[model samples]
Target: MSTIDRRTLLIATGALACVGSAHGHGEPKHPNTGAPVAKEQQPWGIAGEARRATRTVDLRMLDSMRFVPDRLAVKLGQTLRLRIRNTGAVLHELVIGTPAALDEHAALMLRFPDMQHDEPWMAHVPPGKTGEIVWTFNRAGEFAFACLIAGHYQAGMAGRISVRAA
Candidate 1:
């Protein structure tokens, strides 16, 4: 008999899961209400309410593994409604986090390509579809957003966010 390690098991099962699972592409949700969580804090900021969004920033994800307007600037404490459109034929996602955090997550993604974890700071947009992430820049610092989808981030599907202190 042959023994399959965890990594091998996961990869084998992932293929089946990917085929059978329903992929949801959006912010973290409440288990009871299925509503987007609006108040988780991070080094960059916190989840924000859509109604409280003071401004809207439109972003486009391309098959070239890049984000349109790959850089952004915002004032500390301002709430932004990031409207992301996937103009690519493949799925792309916008995940906001510190560089280190993103790097760690991206590494994990490479190992478990079919991981379905969702957070308030990420949006997984499918081909020709749109998604949104409302966030508040409560902390003033540099951050980043990337698509941690298997080979996506490694291919440089990333962007920067600069939050200037008010």
Candidate 2:
């Protein structure tokens, strides 16, 4: 008889779920490596072309589980280039999505700490590294961005995006 420990079983289950499901922010990367999947429009906005970015915002993720300039405001129809620098000693990510979506995604991360997904609205950076995400806010509403790595979100590594009507 073979016995599978609870933790191992749970991790295996979580890995399968992450790879098989296309839920929340985006699809999981195959074998945890590759180019990100295609772009899609969320309620907050769609992936913006780099050429269309009207402004660039720089943010830093710290080991304290915080983002500098956590609050951002932009006009509708404007595209933004987010330049993210991870000053933390561990991996950090910036995933832009609706608040509800971000919450759900964060929960998933808690379950599968090794889960890896990629999207245009997301940037995963290692320690002392930088990444970028270009997004266009077509809808006028509130959005959010967070580091959904395990306990980061719960630690309040999040920020708000306000897209005002033009």
Candidate 3:
């Protein structure tokens, strides 16, 4: 298997292990009422309130390319739910950052022993699979979204996001 496939398998296995062993410490008891709490009240319960709010964006990845929207517009201070689907034969990443930051990260990403696992802003999605990124863009500026998979960016697999002032 390729390096990307190996890393992806490891990540998926780890996530599965986490989900399987996420039970809270014993049964939870309500603080004020001093009563045994429902399963939903457990700290690690899946039905509990979310830690953060979210938004959703659907994107697609083609072979050696990112089919991200040409210009994504959003307001500052909004949490983003970026869902990227990979329809490509090879691995891809969807990273969001300022132009300068992208340039810096791209430089660092190239130096990783395995280019597939180098970028901190990148998430691995196998071909025909989907992945998500929950992010908050706090600054108002023009940010670029790209797939920094080796020569993917140079192949024009990049787009821009405009953050309007609140």
Candidate 4:
């Protein structure tokens, strides 16, 4: 899988926020490719390559701003299904990307807290609810997953992802 330019990703995410707000967050376009992820006719990004999960990771989001087992490990080329449960009494999200990208996105969410959309690498989980994000770790790198709900990130709601060799 190929990486998306940081600038391009940020621009796409910003556009997604704008379009999502205008469309009432009802499934706008995939920002990476400017098409619906449901269309199955386009590629979103490197993180968009979801396949049958070879591993299942169970994580818990806490109200105190923490992710249980915050540091996750996956082999390169391995597909995973992240099963996230919100044990918190509020909304939380899991967005996977580089630290810089996540930091930028967290700031964006702080500005537009109500903005919403579905992306291959994002999973929004409500209180007492569960969500899943299927993804393939194609590259070897240290990445991140975070909850970008307004003050959440500042409250220390984030995790590390280590994708190593196959």
Highest-scoring model, lDDT: 1
Ranking of candidates on lDDT, top first: 1, 2, 4, 3
lDDT of 3: 0.56
Top candidate, metric TM-score: 1
- Candidate 2 lDDT tens digits, 1-166: 1132234335434654666543333332224344443556667788888888999999999999999989999999999999999898887889887787778777878887766555677888878878888899998988899999889999999999999988
Q: What are the candidates' C-alpha RMSDs?
A: 8.3, 9.1, 13.2, 5.4
Q: How accurate is candidate 4 locally (lDDT)?
A: 0.73
Each prediction's total of clashing residue pairs, residues at least 3 apart in sequence or on different chains, is 0, 0, 1, 0
TM-score for each candidate, following the candidate numbering: 0.80, 0.79, 0.62, 0.79
Q: What is the Cα-based TM-score of model 1?
A: 0.80
Which TM-score value belongs to model 4?
A: 0.79
lDDT preference between candidates 2 and 3, better one: 2
* Global lDDT scores for all candidate models: 0.80, 0.79, 0.56, 0.73
Q: Give the TM-score comparing model 3 with the true structure, all chains together.
A: 0.62
lDDT of 1: 0.80
| Candidate 2 backbone collisions, by pair | none
Question: If both were scored by lDDT, which would come out higher, candidate 2 or candidate 4?
Answer: 2
After superposing candidate 2 on the true structure, give the runs of residues whose Cα lies further than 4 Å from its correct spot.
Answer: 1-37
For residues 1-166, what per-residue lDDT tens digits would candidate 3 score against the true structure? 3454345445633553455422221222112243322221111011211235355778888884757565677777666767788898776777665565555545545654143232223455667878665556666767787876567777888888887777
Task: Enumerate residue pairs that collide in model 1.
Answer: none
